[model samples]
Target: MLTMAIVILLLLMCATIPVAVTLIILAFVLGYFYSDFPFYLAAGEVLWTNSENYTLIAIPLFVLIGEILVRCGSARKAYSIMDAWLSWLPGGLIHANIGASVLFSATSGSSVATAATISTIALPEGRRLGYSEGIFSGAVAAGGTLGILIPPSISLIIYGIFTETSIPKLFAAGVIPGLLLAALFCFVTIVCSVIKPSISGQRAKYNWKTRIVGLFSLMPLFLLFFVVVGSIYAGLATPTEAAAIGVLAAVGIAAAGRSFSIAMFTDAVLGSLRTTAMIMLIVLASYFLNFVLSTLGINEQIEALFSGMNLSALETLLLVFCIYIVLGMFIETLSLMVITLPVLAPIVFAQGFDKVWFGVVVIILIEMALITPPVGLNLYVVQGVRKRGSIMDIVVGALPYVLAMFVLLYILVIYPQVALYLPNKV
Candidate 1:
């Protein structure tokens, strides 16, 4: 049954079917061949359950905040400010691309949004300064993946819901690792730039006074992050409520910048609704697929396989990491998470690992997915913004950061505290 299901899934995906539709098709096929239960009825329950999730409300709200910020010119301001301060680094403007991503990720929970927003603002700078296209584009794509790893992340919210873990703890757990990953990306960029001087771009020296002035431009983003993630941590708001607060704060920031208008709000709402519909479709389909898999004893089969191997916990984890990397290269990140967590979460939990820690690890892998080839969403996003380069440029550029992710993955495995410390402290 597993083999058949996978075969059908591959065929569907290869035929260019959408992820959500492919998932639903697989669920129906699996139920028809393998189960006696009514699949249609089961699907209805899944749809209803997904529709009723309050935590899921965070997805659209956060998406709207990102849209508003992007349309209102905050993204450009962030890039300029980060470029002023971080351009002094070895990679020049590339560091700013990453720094801006980290700051924006705190507000925008969508990787595609982060990549798109930063690409628009930073790609022009890269071109004007004669930066290496591959590295510059790769940096934007890779850095944007931080959107999933940082706090107030929609991906983490979905993961928490799937695993029944604490959303706040997952948010807390992501903080240190997210920042660490961002630093590693910048380090990789610096090393590459230092090794190949042409890739470094023009490093414009800035005075402290100028840099300090640039820092002021970052204040709105910082405030939004504090209000959203801070409110959640301080027990002042649920994730949903925090999302609402973020939307309000984002609107105020837009208004203060004189970018708020009926047309802008209309565009933001339309974009948010479109993204939300796509996400909710996948969410609903995944829930149905997960329900079917559970009913068909896939989890029991997996447990038996693990037991038969009698592998150590660390070995099992390493195996799971390998699986994620391979799958990450092909599947959309959110769809990958939704489809796998149902099967893998129980196994990881059974091995005495923390669910929240596992979530951090998985998110890092998802970040890797965003830059990986074939189906890496961020790579395409960055490429779209470039409007001239081949997709492979972004893919090749992201390779180094992908390596950074692998290193981080093993480090997380060896020392789980990297992800758990903050959550534990809080």
Candidate 2:
């Protein structure tokens, strides 16, 4: 049954059906044929429940904040500020790409938004500065993946909802790993630039006074990140509450930049609504599919099959990693998470792995998916911004960062503390 489902899903997707619609079709087919109850009716209830989730409310709020920042031009301003301080690094503006992504990702929980925002600003600048297309575009694509791994990540919030873990802890856990990934990205750029110095262009020259002045521009973002993530850590707000605070802070930042306007605010609201609707559709469809699978005892079959293998925990983890890396290539990130987490999370727990640790691991894999070929959304987004480059440029550019992410995965596997330490302390 599982094999059949996979085949049909692939066929449906190949036929150019929308992902949400494909998921819904699969759920209905499984339920109608395999289940004892009317799964469609149950689906209505599941959809209603998921829609009412206060925690899920964080999705639109964070998306709205990101949209507002993008529209109000604060994102570009923020990027320019980051460039001033970081362009002096070995990789020159590439360092600023990662640095800006890090700051923007803290506010924008969506990787697509982060990539688009940075690409819009960074690509033209790279062209003007004589930077290598491959590395520059790659930096934008790879750096944007941090949007999902960093604090206030929509992915972490959804992971928390699915696994019944503490969202705050997940946020706490992601900080160290996210920053590590950023540093690794930077390190990759530095190493490559040192070997082929021309690939990065000259280290950008900025006066110390000018750089110090630009440092002040970072304060708004820092304060906003602190208010949002800090509120969660200080136990003053739930993740949802913190997200609401983040929205307000983002609006204020946009206003401070003198970019906020009524028209921009309207566009931001519409953008948030559209994005949220698309995400909720997938979430609801996946939830319904999960219910159907559970009702038909497929989940139990999966559990028993894994148990029968009697594989060691480490071996099981390796197998899970393989599954994600393969699945991630074809599916959108959020849809992939919603579809797999229900089945995979339980198995990992059964193997005695920490869900919090595994959550970070899964996010890393998802980050890779965003840059992987064929369907890596970040690649397309970045390429679209370039408006002229071959898509291969984005793919080839992001490849090193992909490798860096793999190394990070291995490190996490060896020492789960990279993900668990902050959560444990908090």
Candidate 3:
């Protein structure tokens, strides 16, 4: 039954059917053949349980916040500030792309939003300055992946809720690794620039006075980050509540800047609704499929398979990491997390790995998913913003960062403390 379902899903995906509908079809087909449960009942139950999740409310709020930031010019201000700070690097605005993404990731919780915001602000600059579209788009696509790895991340909140882990601890755990990945991205950009100076644009330096002026435009984002993330860690609000706080704060910032038009608000709300609906549909379908798979004992089968391998815990972990990377290439990020976390987290925890560390590692892999071919959300987003670039260019450009991610993945494996240390101390 599982084999048939897999075959059907592959065919549907290859045919370019929507992922949510594909998942629902697979779930119903599997449930009908493998179990005596009524397909409609199972489907309805799955949909209700997944949609009724209180934690899932954060998804829209975060999406709304991101839209508001983009509308109100916070995202552009962030890019300007990062450009002032990092444009002197070998890759010029490429570094700013990554830098702005890292900073925006601190405030925004959605990868698509991060990519859209950064690409909207930075892509024109790249073109105007005669930078390579491949590198520029790739940087935005890759940098946007940081949205899931930083604090106040909607993905982490969802992960924690699904896995029954501490969201605050998971948020804390991501901070160090998120910052490290940002630094590594900058380093790689510099190295690539030095090796191929032609691909890198002309380096620009700003006077201190100009840099300081740029800093003022960045304060809104900084304050948003502090309020959202700080509220969570300080025990002042739940993750969902903090997201609400973020939404309100974002609106205030927009109003203060006089960018808060009714049309902007309508667009923000409608955009949030569209994105949230899309995400929730896949999420609901994946949850149902996961439920069916769990009922059919797939998790047990997986656990037994791992146990039968007689591998050490670390070896088992590396194997699972590889699985995520492979699955990431085909699956949407939220669906990927929903389908795997329930099955994988238990095995990981049984091996005595810190839940928080595993969360960061999973998020890094999720970031890779955002840039991979065939189904990378960020790749599509960056491509959508480009009037002419092939999707392959974005994928090719993201290759360097994908390699960097693998290196960082190994580092996290060897030094789990990179993710766990801050959470532990705090």
lDDT-sorted candidate list, best first = 1, 2, 3
TM-score quality measure for candidate 1: 0.98
Residue-level error in angstroms, candidate 2, position 364: 0.4
Candidate 2 per-residue C-alpha lDDT over 1-426 given as tens digits, one digit per residue, 9 for 90 to 100: 887788888898788898899999998887777767777777768889878888998899999989987887767877887788888778899998999899889998989999999999999899998999998999999999999999889999899999999988998899999999999999999898898899876556778888777778778888988999899899899888998998899889888888888989999999999999998888888888888888888888888888999999999999999999998889889888998999989999988999899999999999999999888999999988898969998798899999999999999999999899999998
Error of 3 at 414 (Å): 1.1
Question: Compared with the true structure, what per-residue lDDT tens digits does model 1 show for residues 1-426?
Answer: 878988998899889899999999999999999988888986777789778988998899999999999999988888887888889888899999999999889999989999999998889988999999999999999999999999889999999999999999999999988998998998898899888878877877788998898788778889999999899989999999999999999999999999999999999999999999999999989998888888998768877887899899988988888889899888899999998898888888899999999999999988888888898999988888899969998889999999989888878888999999989877
> What is the C-alpha lDDT profile of model 3 across 1-426, one tens digit per residue?
545766887798888898889888887777778889786765776688778878888889988998888888888888888898889878999999998998888877888889988998888889888888887789899999999998878789878877888888998998989889888888888888888788776556789998989888788888999898889888899888999999999999999999999999999999999988887887788788788888888778888888999989989898998899898999888878977898889998999988888899999998889999888999999888887858898888889999889889989988888888888876
Misplaced by over 4 Å in model 1 are none
Error of 3 at 244 (Å): 1.2
List runs of model 3 lying over 4 Å from the truth. none
**What lDDT does each candidate get?**
0.90, 0.89, 0.86
Poorly placed runs, candidate 2 (over 4 Å)? none
Go through the candidates in order and give the clash count of each.
Answer: 0, 0, 0
Please say which candidate is ahead in TM-score: 1 or 3: 1
Q: What number of backbone clashes does candidate 1 have, counting pairs of residues 3 or more apart or in separate chains?
A: 0
